[model samples]
Target: MKAFITLVFITVTLATYAQTKYSNEFMNIGVDAAALGMSNAVTASTKDVNAGYWNPAGLVNLEDRQLALMHSSYFANIANYDYAAFAMPLDDRSAFGISLIRFAVDDILDTTQLIDDQGNVNYDRISLFSTADYGLTFSYARKLPVQGLNYGVNAKVIRRIIGDFANSWGFGFDAAIQFKTDNNWEFGVMARDITTTFNSWSYDEEAFERVQNAVEGQNQELPETTEITIPKLQLGVAKTYTFHYDYTLRAELDLNMRFAQNNDIISTSFASINPALGFEFGYIDMIYLRGGVGNFQNELQIDNSESLSFQPSFGLGFKYNGIHVDYAFTDIGDQSVALYSNVFSLKLDFSIFR
Candidate 1:
């Protein structure tokens, strides 16, 4: 009962700050500094363990095994997001990976509007709770008999909890396919939440009921609702160029199209579509510089003018002796000045180190 009440507080706190495009919005934030640095435009160019969350087919690039961990400071230190992934090559033709991510806010103080019989504010009744979102995914990829063709699928489980007020469980599926050519051109197609992910929420009304009589002026009731996250199709293409100086340059583009309206975020009258572009420059495979732009939206108008929304990102990376560290700066938009997010990630390739 205590846990449930705490969760209720968490739920209310989360509802006050939710700014999402769909259900399970945390999953859409993207994982790993390396990818975010490029505005997550590497769907076709992605390789290694992080592919567990991107294009699983990219796991084929792992010779043996790889592990990656990432952390992000989101939205002016209001929340923290973290991810970890591991990929292992099962054989020459198959690979598998697992990934986990968590997003949460802590130290929220909960208060009541009810006043005691003596008309004194209840100072001893303050409660603290946290709201968090979690995702776990299992993925597998296989190379087809046809050269340069590969396919992958992911099974995901999701859970969201609010201090004790509400909790939810959800399931979803994702699939991806990729084709590459000897000339360094790659193409990718991905279907996210192909099964139309649904979240079932259950709320505890005990706390609200306890204060109902005292706070009758403000009518409030715990709500029980189910939310569905619509599916989206993403198409991507990338090209790699190799230089005589042992350097490489790559460019990538991606388009995301929503098939259904997300009542949770955008109005049904508006369309949800966006394009992203990214570039990366690498020196002897040891150092890299990346930059990109994403979240282009022009559907709604604010102040009688076409509302503009876009996020710009950039990053740096270092790799040597089987270890890599990466950092990224992503602008989340104006929050006073321009709010920039900082992300850092580390990766270890056991194939080379062990």
Candidate 2:
């Protein structure tokens, strides 16, 4: 019930502000520094610890001990996120993994207006686009007896902070089932951000008081309420096929059930399935190249042609003894070239034991 409410409010807020401001939505874009470089999709067969982010079920592929850390730098010098995960095999059929992800939007300078009813500009103040979010995940995976197939699930708690204000955290869960076919064909299904959250957007008495006084004079009480909603309910099904020559083919279909419209964070989702496809290849285990095209219907020459901007991405990766590094480039489809320029990331993985 709480999850349902959060999504409702987040959606309402987005719909209201969609015409004016751009907000972050599906691409809450994680800090998988490496996977960002390769258009992701490496999780189904990933043997490294970073698998915890892509598909917790992939942890079942970890042979022994591993630890990984990743960081991503986004556009506008805004929020930067870091992710760390540890994984180990519990037995031949099961593995346990723990992951921590932290997000901190860089301090921002915002303008606040102070004016009289007579259209008099009294004064203005500077504020910040502030937010601090963190998520903790506990994941477990078990390999099914048949043909290297595995099933995994992760439960997580997400918390947020903004300008001395924190809202009640929302809970989320991820579940995926993976299957491997002969040669190197694989398939996966995942549900992400199942626990959509909406934050308490109550104005701070200390901070909002300034705006109140600016508009309402001294002791007049204002009668208005503000609330924001977060979108919820997403389901994705993906498939992968690998060649002995080290070439990989990947594709996924993601469906975001938007019960309400959130123009603020445009994606052309409109309660339907969005298609994404990519391929990757490596030469003798040294260098890798990957690329993909994705997005819902939108107005963009490079992608969709109506609602939200489209996304086309590509990535590169390198591997060495017990360590691997990767990177990716993405187009957010924003009209402003600078804002839509690109999204980049880096990932690092190390083996703790043989």
Candidate 3:
């Protein structure tokens, strides 16, 4: 079994050189600290609101109504990402949830080449604008007729805006299945953007043309209306062990692949495959520690050297009286600490108090 797992990891790591490009890449950026700390390998794990985004089927594992909110500074503090979710069990066999994700960059300087009567340059007239992306998700999950199996789906609405000059609207759906065994093993499969999410873009032609003309040999303009997203599949497996019924440990692995056409220099759709590994230690169900590694890929170094990817993450969590707080830190490549990101999340369980 260990050999098989090792082989799979090696295969995924080798394929990491290829990266997928899709609309709303921010959607793939993890929102929950616990999940992010674990390198986003939570498809088969449960008991948290993050499941609404990772694998809806895991919602069935939630034991109480929950409200969760998270925030993170991304990419050298140039942007901010925020997420909020609410989940409640509809009955003994079903659950319902909703979540919102937003990524935004503020105070961007929108500059245009300016010429006075004498063709002089003016740098003081630069205007500021912002770009934002949003996703709203509605989810439902239920226990299947067969024991230990669950299924769920997420319906999503997406929006993107660039300083009032361009904007887009999109819609997509995601589905997942999870199964658990009596021996503390769990498996999950999630099909993200199952129907090929689409985004219709509208741009101010006049403004767009001005920007296009300013750049030399720039002819690739966004379409006025079209689909912008592609489908992806993620599979996960996990196992849990208990020590004297007080201390518990869980290990998980996940594989993610995109099935859409990639037109980049590396045209193989298989190049987008990625693998992740994670571990969690829990104490009395009140405190937790997590570590993970993922986002493996290839990039060009400052000297045009081949550089491999390395992303490590760790997190700490505490729960008290129905409230949970989590903190996580993740390194962004080989850059200094300034390139790293911090994630913080808070969760409240109403049922826990009841």
Per-prediction TM-score: 0.88, 0.70, 0.84
Each prediction's total of clashing residue pairs, residues at least 3 apart in sequence or on different chains, is: 9, 19, 0
Clashes by residue pair, model 1: 4-164, 6-163, 6-164, 7-162, 7-163, 7-164, 7-165, 8-164, 8-165
Give the true-structure RMSD of model 3: 9.5
Strongest candidate by lDDT: 1
Report the Cα lDDT for residue 276, model 2. 47
- In angstroms, give how far residue 17 of model 1 lies from its true place: 12
Q: Distance from true position, residue 351, model 1, in Å?
A: 2.2
Cα deviation at 108, candidate 3, in Å, is: 1.1
At residue 118, give the lDDT of candidate 2. Answer: 77
Give the candidate order by descending lDDT. Answer: 1, 3, 2
Report the candidate with higher TM-score, 1 versus 2: 1
Model 2: runs farther than 4 Å from truth? 1-27, 42-47, 109-129, 195-204, 214-270, 300-309, 331-354
Local accuracy of candidate 2 as per-residue lDDT tens digits, 1-354: 332332333333323432422222423454454455444444455545766666777788877777777665556656576777788889988999988887777563333333345766543533455656677788888888888688888877666554442233545667776777775566665555544433323435554444334322333332222223343443444565566866655554444345444433343445444444556666667677777655544443555444554456777777776566666666444333435324433334445234
Candidate 3, after superposition: displacement of residue 293 in Å?
1.1
Model 1, TM vs. native:
0.88
Better of 2 and 3 by TM-score: 3
Q: Candidate 1: lDDT over CA atoms? A: 0.79
